[model samples]
Target: MTLALTRDELAEYLHEVFPQIRDDFAIDDLSPERITMRLLTAERHLRPGGTVSGPSMFALADVAVYAMVLARIGKKALAVTTNCSLDFMRKPEAGRDLIAECRLLKLGRVLAVADVLMFSEGGTDPVARASMTYSIPPA
Candidate 1:
């Protein structure tokens, strides 16, 4: 499918809808099948051991897929995650940003499915992987 929103537009829409997390993520790239996003990791994102927390990684995955869906379907803030399966493969590198590469698997009328791979910035191996299903709001 063709893009309905550009990278800048998606970022703006996200900031408008989710102001609380407006500064947490950045759009790295946007494409028909995939979207790349980065989470600017900070002290607040870390756990007791100085590693990035699981919830922080999960947020990256969720937002990456959410942005991908909006890129193809336009601004639909009501579209929400229906199910998510995440695997923490390895501990994320400390003091590094996290990158989430989200691939759209299916974009149906009511449901959208995507897979996300998250890695510490500049890392070769993934730190986490996620499969997510989103419930799209009717137009």
Candidate 2:
């Protein structure tokens, strides 16, 4: 399906609907096939060892999929995660932003599934991987 929201429109919608996390993420790229998201890592997102925390990575993964679903299905802020499986693979680099690449595995009338790979900025290897399923609200 064609994208229902452009990158800017999606970003704006997210800011409007989720004001609490408005400053935490940026949409780096967007398309029907995949979306690239950046977590603007700060002290609040890092753990004691100066690496991006598990929770922060989870947020990135969750948001990336949510953004992808909204981009395809229009501004449905009520869509919520029903299942998430995340794997922390390696240490994220210090002083670097975390990036998540998301691809929708399936997008149906009531549900969507996505896979996400997260990496530190400028890194080739993924620091984490995630699979998530979201429940879509009825129109």
Candidate 3:
């Protein structure tokens, strides 16, 4: 499938539709099958041990897949996650932003599945991995 939205357009749409989290995520790159997103880590994203929190990483994964789905499906604000499985492999560095690379595993008429790999900025090893399923609203 072709991409329905460019990176700039997607960013604008996200800001207009989801203002609460618009500032938290940045689209690094986008394609028909994959999207790379960055979580602009702040102090509020850190946990008690001064490491990036699980919730923060989960948010990154969720948004990454959401962006991927939107990239192909256009501005479908109602597309909602139906299932999510996440694995935390290592602790994320508090000083570095988190990057989530999401690949669309399946995109059907009513369902979309994506796998996300998350890493700390400038790090080679992945910090977390996620699989998410989104239910698309009927056209």
Candidate 4:
């Protein structure tokens, strides 16, 4: 299926609506059932044990899934996450950037579910995994 919004368009929407996270992430690519997000990692994103902070990972997962949904549905700012569950599988490399590859599992009238796998830049194993559900507001 064709996407309603392009990568650049979604990035602009994010910048305008979610200014606080403007620097936190950027869209790497967007496709029919896939999306890639890059985490603008910095010292602030690092935890005490030389790994990315949990909140940082969570943010990446949330934004990545949101991007996936918006790509399919266009500028749906009212679509809010209704559920989120994340598991940190391993410690992410401290210096490298993090990437989230998202896949939408189900898209319904009111809710959309997506699963995200987070990798540490060039790493082969996923450092974290997340499942997110968004509540799409009435039209």
| TM of each candidate vs. truth | 0.98, 0.98, 0.98, 0.97
Best by lDDT: 2
lDDT score, residue 51, model 1? 99
Q: How does each model score on lDDT? A: 0.95, 0.96, 0.94, 0.92
Q: Which stretches of candidate 3 lie over 4 Å from their true place?
A: none
Span of 10 residues, lowest total lDDT, candidate 1: 16-25
In model 3, where is the ten-residue run with the lowest total lDDT? 16-25
> Model 2 residue 27 lDDT?
100
lDDT of 4 by residue, 42-122 (tens): 999998988899999999999998888888888888899999999999999889999999999998889999999999999
The 10-residue segment with the lowest total lDDT in model 2: 46-55
Q: How do the residues 3-97 of candidate 3 rate in per-residue lDDT, one tens digit apiece?
A: 99999999999999999997799999999999999999999899999999999999999999988999999999999999999999999887999
Instruction: Show the colliding residue pairs in model 2.
Output: none
Q: Higher-TM-score candidate among 2 and 4?
A: 2
Task: For residue 72, give model 3's deviation from the true position in Å.
Answer: 0.1
RMSD of 1: 0.6
Cα-based RMSD of the predictions, in order?
Answer: 0.6, 0.6, 0.6, 0.8
Q: Which of the two, 3 or 4, has more TM-score? A: 3
lDDT of 1 at 89: 97
Q: Give the TM-score of candidate 2.
A: 0.98
Question: How does model 3 score by TM-score?
Answer: 0.98
